[model samples]
Target: MSDQIILTTSSHLEGYRVTEHLDIVSAECVFGMNVFKDMFAGIRDIFGGRNKSSQNALRDARTSCLEELRKEAREKGANAVIGVDLDYSEISGGGKSMLFLVATGTAVKVEKV
Candidate 1:
């Protein structure tokens, strides 16, 4: 069911016509920056270089959020989700940091045009 669902950032999917608009669906996924990773990131900021760990963490969060969004759309009897949007933010204080990710889209029923 997961693989059968289509997701798009555009308002509509090409070659597919929206027959019924279900409802909006969203999912959230969060990741915390451990002290070890935070230390490495700080060092990278001083050295001015790429941060592979940070990038990977962000990518992983996105994947998880989208996957859950897909599941929600499926449960709503939607074959696809259009106008997909992904948002990310950071929360930090007291020597601890976390990354929050939210994936949202409009669930719809679609068929080949």
Candidate 2:
């Protein structure tokens, strides 16, 4: 991670001004749930309990997606990313359940006010 790179969900960062607009950047991650975990999750869902396995998988995917977004922003010479958004979806095909996570933001150069 680049120390200079700032990420925020807001459209603007406090105490900093956007000096240049680079481009829109995005990163995506996909992971699958194993059969055992899927079975456990299904049971948990039926019983109406929190699915720790599913939650952990989502957390890991989100982390990876954010890291990729940071790398992209740094490569584009962006000091900050604003207006960030995250999306999560389930992709099931061929009897396999997969999770997809995507992070997106506008890369920009910001100067401290």
Candidate 3:
């Protein structure tokens, strides 16, 4: 697993075993500009209130990140991803926000194992 496969088929599992033995790789990956957004988010928070802009920004970023992961998985010939995880962080000094949508799973050709 290369930490960039978006699973969309399996509900009980993150990955679907299609082959006996094979390694999954992340062929493509995409992410949103988090640093800049985080900074602004922090500023908004300091005002003793929540900023809807910041919330919206994070949501958009997450969506974009996931889309990228799915595309990468498709390119790698993976039907689903396992052990999917999402990580978010703020830049130092609250300068920006970073969203990392990572997915990991085994890629294999389907057959009787």
Candidate 4:
């Protein structure tokens, strides 16, 4: 992770001016649900309550995706990423379920305004 890189969902950053528009960068992560978690989540679904397991998985995935995004931006010589977006999806195949998280943003060089 690059501490110098700023990440934001907004298109504009306060106290910074975009000097150059680099390119769009994206990162994706996939997490597989274990059998025990699936069972507990199913139970929680039936009870109509929050599923901590799934929530934690998503949180970790988002964090990892953001880290990857920051790395990509740094590699591109970008000091900030704006217009960031996150997407989540689930895939079920071969009797298994997996969660996918994708983060995208426009890498840009920014200077203090």
What is the lDDT of every predicted structure here?
Answer: 0.85, 0.84, 0.51, 0.85
Model 1: worst 10 consecutive residues (lDDT sum): 39-48
What's the C-alpha lDDT at position 111 in model 2? 89
- Against the hidden true structure, what lDDT does model 1 obtain? 0.85
RMSD of each: 3.0, 3.0, 6.8, 3.0
lDDT per residue (tens digit) for residues 71-110 in model 2: 9999999989999999988888898887778899999999
Off by over 4 Å in 2: 35-48
Q: 2 or 3: which has the higher TM-score?
A: 2
Candidate 3: worst-modelled 10 consecutive residues by lDDT: 20-29
In order of appearance, the predictions have TM-scores of 0.84, 0.83, 0.49, 0.84
lDDT of 4 by residue, 9-109 (tens): 99999998999999999999887767436657466444457666666667778889999999999999998999999998888889898878899999999
Supply every candidate's count of residue pairs whose N, Cα or C atoms clash at under 3 angstroms.
0, 0, 12, 0
Score residue 32 of candidate 4 by CA lDDT: 78
Q: Candidate 2 at 24: error in angstroms?
A: 0.3
Please, what's the RMSD in Å of model 2? 3.0
Error of 3 at 77 (Å): 0.6
Candidate 3 on 1-113: residue-level lDDT in tens?
45354354342342334553245533223344654456575664545566666667667776776676567666666655444456665333365433444444454434222
